[model samples]
Target: MSGVTRDDRVHVLGIRHHGPGSARAVATALAELNPQIVLIEGPPELDAVAPLAAAQGMRPPVAGLVYAVDAPSTANFYPMAVFSPEWVALRWALDHGREVRFLDLPANVSLVLADEEESEAPMDPIRTLAEAAGFDDPERWWEDAVELRYHGLDIFHAVLDAMHTLREGHVPDLRTRRREAAMRRVLRAALRSEASTIAVVCGAWHAPVLVPSAFPTQAADSALLKNLRTTKVAATWVPWTSTRLARMSGYGAGIESPGWYHHLFTARDQVVGRWLVRVAHLLRREHLDVSSAAVIEAVRLAQALSVLRNRPHPGLPEVLESCQAVLCGGSDVPMRLVARKLLVGDILGGVPRETPMVPLARDLDATRKRLRLKQSAAQQDLDLDLRTQSHLDRSKLFHRLLLLEVPWAESAETSRTKGTFRESWTLEWKPELEVALIEASGFGTTIPSAATAVVAQRTAEADIAELSTLVETTLTADLPVALSGVLAALDERAARQHDITRLMAAVEPMARVRRYGNVRRADTELVQRVLTGIVTRITVGLPAACTAVDEEAGRELRELIDGVQRGIGLLDQRELRAVWLSALRSVADRLGVPGIIAGRAVRLLLDAGLLDVTDAGGRLSRQLSMASDATQAAGWLEGFLSGEAALLVHEPELLEIVDQWATGVDAELFDHLLPLLRRTFAEFTATERRDIGLRVKRIDRGAGASGIRSDDTTLDHERASLVVPGILELLR
Candidate 1:
């Protein structure tokens, strides 16, 4: 087996990534050896930003972000936590003023060669060791062996020996070989340099092959890395989160319990006791009944379980079990809360303010600071009163980010009674959004500029509906220039657009902006003119659009008609309403119009007082005539009563017409129409449907002239007399 010689200048420390015990051991070993240089396993592209780790605002749980300059989304993160061994080595080297370098293949090459196939199957040394030790879980075994135990420098030596044995006859895949070659190449360079002593910190799996005696010649290492594909890569420091460090988060080197490891690293003594105390406190905060006595018992139980399991110390499993038993009373619900809030953790790290960032990112940071809106990992609800300048600006900023496809905030539903002056939003900042910001940097250097550019680009291809949405978004964002371009595109599209349904769909947003523009102090005259033109075009083409339609098309046209009616209500302009009502009348009078459309048109006319109750009853009676197709009659009823049945309850004439039609239908036709009729009535509230049912019963009993009912002589007077005394007492 390969091993480091006693007199060798290079000391290799094999470590588990993000392992607390490994991190502690690395710091201890580095202090003792005081190596002249330290090497860490990461992309070399990150070396430029490595010094930022020591910056004033620099924090752990941050990552070295590297990405292809041309394609920013093709990226990789080299994350470091407070308990990471490589992080310990890096800080040690930086504090001692020793030379430091990354030992893996450059990100530029790896990113370009990402698609290359592996030459062989990779081996899991940890799993192999765990199985040999009679443990099913490699993570638990490693935690017991290295992470939970304090082995100092000896643990690294043990890991190295075990890995050597494990890899005695194993052949690494091409990517693994190339990565090891890169480390070796970096090692050789450090050896040739003036540094007399070097410390290389890397994953344990690579430790055996990295020893100089394992592959003495440089030619093979050089051959593995020759003429590799490359690209220009940029690197920077960005904040990270503990949640993203979990294995379930799809990170390659993620750990199961970042928060647990963090607690282990930070607490100097009584690891299990401290952890249980924290759990007790968390449970208490959640309004659970956790007593100090329970915490102490939990600690005792954890230690006992560790001993029973033959563990040197209480590991995460023991502590978790103890907590579940004592603090939580075996309830899984509180434990889920513990796992999410304490185990995986919601901790978000920070980077130094002076860390390198794209211009757009910098601008946004400045804007956030100026607005006093601090970024947070936790979700927060923001209720903005747009009448206030600051709130308006904040709303605009969120809208701009949304337009640029950086969804840091999502628009939430607000109470309609709160009026147009208030907007609701949910804000949650994520670390990956930094990469998104980088991707959007090419658009412009500022938020407004980038958002405007995005709108302009999208406007060129936007249909009338898309353009209408864009217009509203741009108006809300308060981008006057982009709004102008979008309006022009909308007008151009609306002029020649033959799809009247699209024209109808555009009305609501246009009418909304025209009506609420005053709240934002925005000019709405242009929107008003555009809306008028759209309404006029809709009225002219709607009659023809309603002709020659199938069932699906008929349903769609009915919905569009409802939408246009709603828009006209929002505008509340007499001229537009008159024109729209006239159009509906034409649709009702036109031949070959779908029964649903004609029925809806008559209903709207009656609601608007353009048609009297008698006229509306005549139209309905005609639609439901004996000669009329049963399916057509059902469609007409569905379109008229699709949303509400209150009209039928109040308008007894209309109800009588429908009742007659229903009673007149043959049993066969009624059976065919039952499903359709049920679906239409299902849309109504229970109260409305009940009221209609009661009215129908009255009509059937021939007592429709009066709502009151006569007394019944068959009433149970003896049973009713029991409630009479109680009713009299309540009345008093």
Candidate 2:
């Protein structure tokens, strides 16, 4: 709330935020009643741009950019697009030779407020409404919600009121309340600034709250926000299109409908019913199926519904019933489609024929024309994905420009498929994208250069966790131009620098490609060679590097080792696995740790399942022989691990280790290890054991079920083993 409110109040124009209809109406209202001072609801950070906004050639969709004075890298933006009410209000003020001012919270403090509540959640009000109305599309649900208004006069007000209420219910937080208070403060200041009647334009939500006489003016450093920061602001106009207003986006200006509201504005004498019929005719011409007879029937149905609801004039509901009957053949089929087209029709805007320009607008037009993107018509069936993966190189500039996340070029895609790296793009030249490109140029000249610059700026401003994500994205790109920036970002995230997840983005990729010289593949050679050379210096300081990794990180290193082995060519597969084994053994020895016997066993089990499992009883028997040594134990474990036997059952002949040690070993020592043997048995569920019992026992369960039973001695031994205290404890 850091804007200037003047006593020279000019005009107060209430409007719907981003409402094209409201903008058009306000423009007319302003021209008819000229004002000297115009105030708008916006972040006061753009106060510096008041002159810029009023300047010739500036355009809408240009944001009033604000960089935090304390941290220049930290920026907050308030964007405007054509068809926005505030922009129109400003233009009218400028045309009347009046001063225009932004009246709202400044960007830095606003961002601080928003950042304090850092939650990126979307509400499900629309989704819930869609479900209630039996429509999956949120837009369609809105149509139904609004369509209900046609039933009667009482219902019409109720319907609009309900929609408004629902909208409030869905906001993540009640920022609007705070925003409205800020707006009121600005409006009161305008009144105190010497103007009798001031023009204050803002979202309709703030209209009821902006009562000047009842609301007192706020001081510059008011109690609500003593810590607020203020800056300059501006406004402009730009061409708009239908698709950009689709609500498919997260942030931007919006005009949910243009054409229908335009009709509502222009044809004051024509009732809404006749207007809808005209819409149906337009739909029919577009091959959308609304016949003239259908419109007539729809009108009849609407009148009947109006009578049924006991209303003098049809609201939105009766019109809907009429549409359903006529357009949808008594079904909610074609009517729903026509409803969207008429009510929430696409957002299409054009430059004003005679309007003062903002500087931002001229620059955007020039950039778009230079890039050969001034043509707005979109070509269908152009799949950029396949084309890129194919041999088509549009140009280095085009390829690089495509990489920037400009939301323009995003078109409505009625496609459903499960595929990676697929995105919907509309590919139009918008003033906003051009503005962004110029803004990005502050960091670097070219698009890639600008991207790198933006990354650096953001990284400089981001916290540790955010910086870590940037590192991951940079690693995925794996381009050299960002190397310095990546390292610097890594440094900023240094509090989390020791986090292996953070370090691994830099480490794992390098490790994979490091030993490429050992491979015979040509596709990955150059990158791998570079990666190996880079990591070689770091790898040379092994103990130092290992200190950054915790035990869990060590386990991940093992997994990475496995991944690297998997990546080796078929001819070198065994060699690669052996290399990892040797490396693991070396690392283990250096750390004075036990060999990874459990890891060896687990890896084997996962890889080959029961089919490759060795006979645990037989292997143990061999390993425990009096002639066996450490080497022999090692050899036996290697063989046992090489063949996976995650499951086991014992036979006396197979229990040679028990037979050899049960009589001679320290009884306590042998008992302590027995739990492991019992756990192996208990690991499998009863059903699984019943099915696989014979496999491990080498008995044909089908034959055993045939009444061929095991001997009495075997049964006795099983009972004794199952009864042991340690074994029983393990079972639990």
- Clash count, one per candidate: 0, 54
Model 2, residue 506: C-alpha shift (Å): 7.0
lDDT of 2 by residue, 1-732 (tens): 101123423334444455444565567656655666777887654454455555655644444445544443345444455556676776677667787777776564565665565443433443555577665333334334543333322222333244456655444344444565676666666666766556667644444345443354465325556655543322333444444443422123333454444454455564556776775776677687677777777777777776776655554556666666667667665655565666555433444323323233344345445655533523323334422432122222333343355544443457532122333444555435534543444455445565566566666776544554454344333334564565455454443345433333444433333333122121333334433332333233333444335445544554443433333322243533444344433343243221223234333433433222244444455455655443324323332333223333333233223334334445565465454434444545665445343443443223431234355544677667866775335444
Candidate number with greatest TM-score: 1
- TM-score against truth, every candidate: 0.92, 0.50
Q: What is the lDDT of candidate 2?
A: 0.47
Q: Ten consecutive residues with minimal summed lDDT in candidate 2?
A: 1-10
What digit string (tens of lDDT, one per residue) describes model 1 on residues 575-658?
Answer: 999999999999989989888888889889888999998888888888899999889999888877766677898898888888
lDDT of each: 0.84, 0.47
Identify the candidate with maximal lDDT: 1
Q: Distance from true position, residue 522, model 1, in Å?
A: 1.5
